[model samples]
Structures are given as C-alpha cells and as structure tokens.
Target: MTTLDNGTNSTPAPTLPAKPAVSMFAIGTAIGAILLTIITAISVGFSLGEIISNFGRKNSVVEGLLNPDWGQIWSRRSRSAFIETLQLAVLGTATGATVALPLALWSTTFGNPNRALRTLVRSFNNVIRSIPDLLWALLFVTAVGIGALSGLLALFFFSIAVTTKLTSDTLDGIDMGPIEAANASGASLTQMLRSAVVPQILPSYTSFVLYNFELNLRASAVLGLVGAGGIGARIEFFRGRGDWEKLWGLVVMFFLVVFIVERISVTLRRRLI
Candidate 1:
C-alpha cells in the first residue's frame, strides 16, 4: 500500500493574486465641485450686498412693489395697448413659422438633394440666426418709420430663427428606416417627407411653434421701446412723464401676460412631449 501511494504525489493549488482597490475618482470630483460652489457662493454674496446697498438709498424697489397702480391697469388705453401687443405677437409668430417650415427642410441634409445646396442653405440659416432680433427690430424701425410693422418684422425673424433650428434638429433625429423604405418604393422627395417625416415630427414641431409664440408675445411687449408699436411705447411714455403709477400698471400687465403665456406653454408642452 505504501509503494502504491508513492506513485502519486499531490500538488498544492495555485493562489490567485487579489485585485487592487479602485481609486476614489468620484469622491475627488465631488470635493472639487464643492469647493467651486463655495467660491461662487462667496462671490455672489458680495455682489448681492453691493447691489442691495446701492439700491437701498433710492427705495424705488420697495415703493414699486408695495403700492402698485391697480386703477391704471383697468384704463381703456392700457387695455388697448395690451391687445395691440397680443396682435403683433400672433401675426409675427404665424408668418415666421410658416416661412420657417420650408427653410428648415432646405437646411437639413435629408431634404437637400445635393450636398452643396444643403451646405449653402445651412450657412444662410446660421447667418440669419447670428443677428439678434432686437438689432433687426432697430433696423426695421429705421426703415419702416417706427410702428407695428417694425415690431412684426422683428418678431417674424426671431421666430424663423427659433423654428428653423428646432425643426431641422427634429428632422435630423427621425427614423431612417421609413425614409429608406419610401425611397425604395419610388417616392419623390416631397412625397417621402410628407408621408414619412412630417407625420412623425409634427407634434414636436407644433410644440416648438407654440413655444416661439409665447416668446414673441414677450418680445412684442418690449418692441415699443424701440418705437415698434406696443405696450413698451406706453411704458416709455409714462416713464418720461414720471407717472410711476401708470408705469407700475404696465409692469403688472406685462407680468400677468407672461405668466399666462408660460402656463399655457407648459401645459401644451406637457401634453405634446
């Protein structure tokens, strides 16, 4: 039995090396972010104190809020001014969005039959967007002699910038399979877009248009500051006359309009998105 046991000698199992512990990269990042936040807080606190001390001497902030002019808000002229602002926003948004649809399609690679054409269209769109709407309003006011037309023109261009960018992005993210299938079935570019892409992105496009309308509403209210014809002109008039009561009413009206538009936009976005 001993002779038989000597024929087979058992070997020990090999030991596997342990893995090194993971580094605390996440913790380090957190610490760095905390330090940055502390620095930013200190800077903001100092700036806020300076602002408070500067404004405290005038006492305009307290007087403005505590005793707003409710009577002036109910005046017929004020109501008319508010209506004019709304009309300007609505017209501008409608016109801008309508024009933007074609431009958006042209700007996208998918809609462009030729690569060079697509590049050109995209560049033009970029150029248009680069110019601020207020500047456009100023130029138009100079040309059109300071009226609602100038405000309308400004809002229209602004809407185009917003709508085209959003629509092009939506077109870019669409499912390619449908596009390919439409092409395979001998669909024309117009047919393919109408049948495949438009249907899919219509909801998002509508939502964006609505959002732009809300923005235009706010813009129209200020367009009168440049003599573009809206509540902004009234605000300027009251301010020039030193009628703080009327000015306060205009401010309240502006706030109310903004709040209402925001609420509607939020509700519509929620439903659409």
Candidate 2:
C-alpha cells in the first residue's frame, strides 16, 4: 500500500507471481495408468468372493506343499541335479555377460561412432531379449536333444539380454568428462572406452551380472521341464508320478539354494555400488 499525502488517500500497487503450469502429458499419463490398472484387474477376474470361495479347499497341490518330504536333498540324484543347476547358472552368466559388456559398449554412440553399427547391435539385442527364457530353452532342447548344453544355451542368451540392457543404460549416464579427455588425448575408440567408459560403469555392470545370475538360477530350474537340463527334469519326473511331496520338497530345496546364492550376490552387489 502507498499513501498519497496530497489527496489523503491510500493507493496500492503490487505484482503477483503467476501460478505454476500443469502438464497435460503428466495428467494423461496418470489417467492412462489408472485405466490400465482397472482394465487389468477386471480382465484377471479380481474378486474378493472368488478368493474367499477358493480358500482352504483340500487339493493335491496344497497338500503336497503343506506336507513336503524335506529329505529330497539326501538323494544322490537330487544332489547331482542341484550341482548341475549351479554349473549351468554360473557358466551361462559368465559367458553371456562377458560378451554383453562389448555388445553393450558397441550399442552406444560414444563407444561406437558408427550409427549403422550401433543400430544393428541394438536391433540384435532387442531380438534376443524379445524371446522368453523358456522359449529359448524349448528351442535349444529341440535343436540340441535336451541336455545341459541346451539349458546353458538358453541361459546364455537370457543373460546377454539382461546384462547388455542394464550395462547399456548405465553407459548412457557415465561421466562425459573422461570421455572428452580421452578424445582430446587422441585415444582410439577402443582405448577411450576401455580406460574411460569401462572404469566408470564397471561396478554397476558387475552388479547387473550378479543380478542376472540370480535370475538364471531360478530359470534353470524351469528349463529342465523342457528337457534343457538342471533339476527341472527331476522335478518333472516327480510331478509326472504325482509325487506331490517329493516335488514340493525338491522345489523348496532348490529355492533355498537360490535364496542363499541371492543373499551372497546381493551382498557383493551392495559392496560394488
């Protein structure tokens, strides 16, 4: 407010800040998400009545899960299958993730200057990732005659998809300073990537590889259902004979192993980051 002495009146002059603008895009996105959730819920038959009606009914699956044998681990076959699963996960992650590092690097503009090459690499990665792990297992099983080799092949491509996608994303956010420095120092593309880029994303890349291993471990169990190898085959055997107790017992034991591995991997990943 300003006082006008001559007229004995008060006059006020002020400026008000404008309100913040809202984005239509954000509003549309929220609305779309809510609608999608509702549609999905309806399509999946989500209902409290359905859940209540199905609860506590006696069934083979429930009974088996409840009364697990808990001694399947003592069987020689079970032990061998567990070891094979471990081997498949380890070998698959190692080989696939190793290749993924280079493939991921090549997908980026900084690491690979050629736009054509980058597009090709990304396209290949996308194609590999589009195939589900089980489908890959089935395909390999058909091609390779249902063995550990087939399982390994499935896990390998799956690992490539997981690790490369993660590593490539990390590459996008790396410190451009070192990249620029390397370029100024007349470093070759390979040298610049190795010295500047790889070091920046190494910890993250390794953590992703460990995470991929955990996933591979779980998938390896299922791959055996398609005869790709691992304890899944043993599980299928028990399942075929309607030995619910043994099947559930085997599943429980296998998950326990996976849980332990995940714990270790998670710990290591934490340290890495």
Candidate 3:
C-alpha cells in the first residue's frame, strides 16, 4: 500500500508474484502411490481384522523361537551342515561376483559401446534379478537334482544379481576425467576400465562382494528346503519332523555365525569405502 506523505489517503497493497505450485510430477507420484497401495491391498485381501484375530493364537513359530534347543549347537550333523553352508556361500559369492564385475561394466556405455550387447546384458541382469533366491534354488534343484551344487548355483545367480546391481549404480557416478584421459592417451577399452574405472570402484565393488557373501550365507541355510544342499536340508528335516526346538537351535546357531561374519564384513566394507 502507498500512503500519501501529508494526507489520509491510502492505496490497496500490491501483491507479489505467486510462488510455483507443487510439481505435477510430485503430485502424480503421490497419487500413483495411493492408487498402488489401494490396488495392492485389494489384490492381496489385506485385512487388519484377520491379523487381529490371529495375533493372540499360539503358533509353532513362536513356540520354536521361545524354546530353541541350544544344545543342538554341538551336534556333529549341525556342525557339518554349518560348514557346508559356509562353503556354499564362499564358492557362490566368488563365482557369481567374479562374473558380475564384467557384466556390470559391460552394461554401461563407456564399457560396452555396442548398443545391442549392452541392452542384452542389462536385460539378462534384470531378468536374473527379478527372480528371487528361493525360486532360483527351485529351478536349479529341478535342473541339477537336489544337491549342494544346486544351492551353489542358486547363490551364484543371486550374488551376480546383487553385486552387479550395486556395482553398476556406482559405475555411472565415477569420475569421468580419468576415463577421458585414459582414452585420450590411446588406451584400449579394457585397459581404460581396468586402469581408470577399477580403481574408482574397487572399494565399492569389494564391499558389494562381501555384502553378497553375507546374504548368501544366510540364504544357504534355507536352500536345503528345496534339496539344493547346505544347512537348509537339515532345516527341512527338522521342520518335517516337527522338531521346532532343534530347528530353531540350528537356525540360531547358523545366524550367530552369520552375525559374526557380517560384523567382520561390515568392518571391512567401512574400511574399503
């Protein structure tokens, strides 16, 4: 409002320009999420009442968790199963993560310039990733006949999916200056990636491998359910016999080892990154 200096006259206040409204993209995202939630709930038959009615009921899972036979930790079978699980995890992570590195690099433009090859690699990676660890185990078990080899194969594809996705995310954000300089100096694609790209993401890549190992260790415990081998087979036996206490004990013992390894891996990853 403007006021006259020596008079009682006033003019209406001038309004400043309006600030921008919320973005359509943000609004659309919110709307889409709400719609998706609604659709998912409907499809899944989500019901709070069902959960409310069931929550107070006694369950074998709860009983097992409450009364785990910790003495099972000393069983020779348990020990052997645990060792097998560890071997499966180590071997699977080693093989899968090795292949994942090349696959991750090839999926990027700077690594594999061939559009068709890059797309194929990306599509394959995506397909492998879309399948869950359990499903992989089932497929491998079917193909190879229920054994540790099948479990190893499951973890292999699983580790590839995990490591490749995580590593590829880092690749796109690497410092491109060195990449350009390497190319400018007449280095070949493989040499540039090895020299320039590898150094930048080695820490992250190693960390991903370690993390994938941790996951494989945990997953290897259940692969036995599908006869793919490892401690999972013991778990299935315990479950089938309704030996909840022993089953829980085996599960707990396995996880304790996993917990310790994960702690060590976390420390290493922190040091790497």
Model 2 C-alpha lDDT per residue in residues 1-273, reported as the tens digit of each score: 122342354434443555668799999999999999999999998998877777756779889999999999779999999899999999999999999999999999998889999899999999999999999999998988879999999999999999999999999888999999999999999899999999999999999999999999999999999999899999999999999999999999889889998999999999999
Q: Put down candidate 1 lDDT per residue, 10-59, tens digits, no spaces.
A: 63444455565766997889999999988998887757678878877766
Model 1, which residues run further than 4 Å from truth? 1-50
Runs of candidate 2 with Cα error greater than 4 angstroms are: 1-48
Local distance difference test values of all predictions, in order:
0.84, 0.92, 0.92
Off by over 4 Å in 3: 1-31
User: Which sequence of candidate numbers ranks them by TM-score, best first?
Assistant: 3, 2, 1
Q: What TM-score would every model get versus the actual structure?
A: 0.80, 0.86, 0.87
Q: By descending lDDT, how would the candidates be arranged?
A: 2, 3, 1
| TM-score-superior candidate, 1 or 3 | 3
Measured by lDDT, the strongest candidate is 2
lDDT of 3 by residue, 169-264 (tens): 999999999999999999999999999999999999999999999999989888888988888888889888999999999889878888999999
Of 2 and 3, which scores higher on TM-score?
3
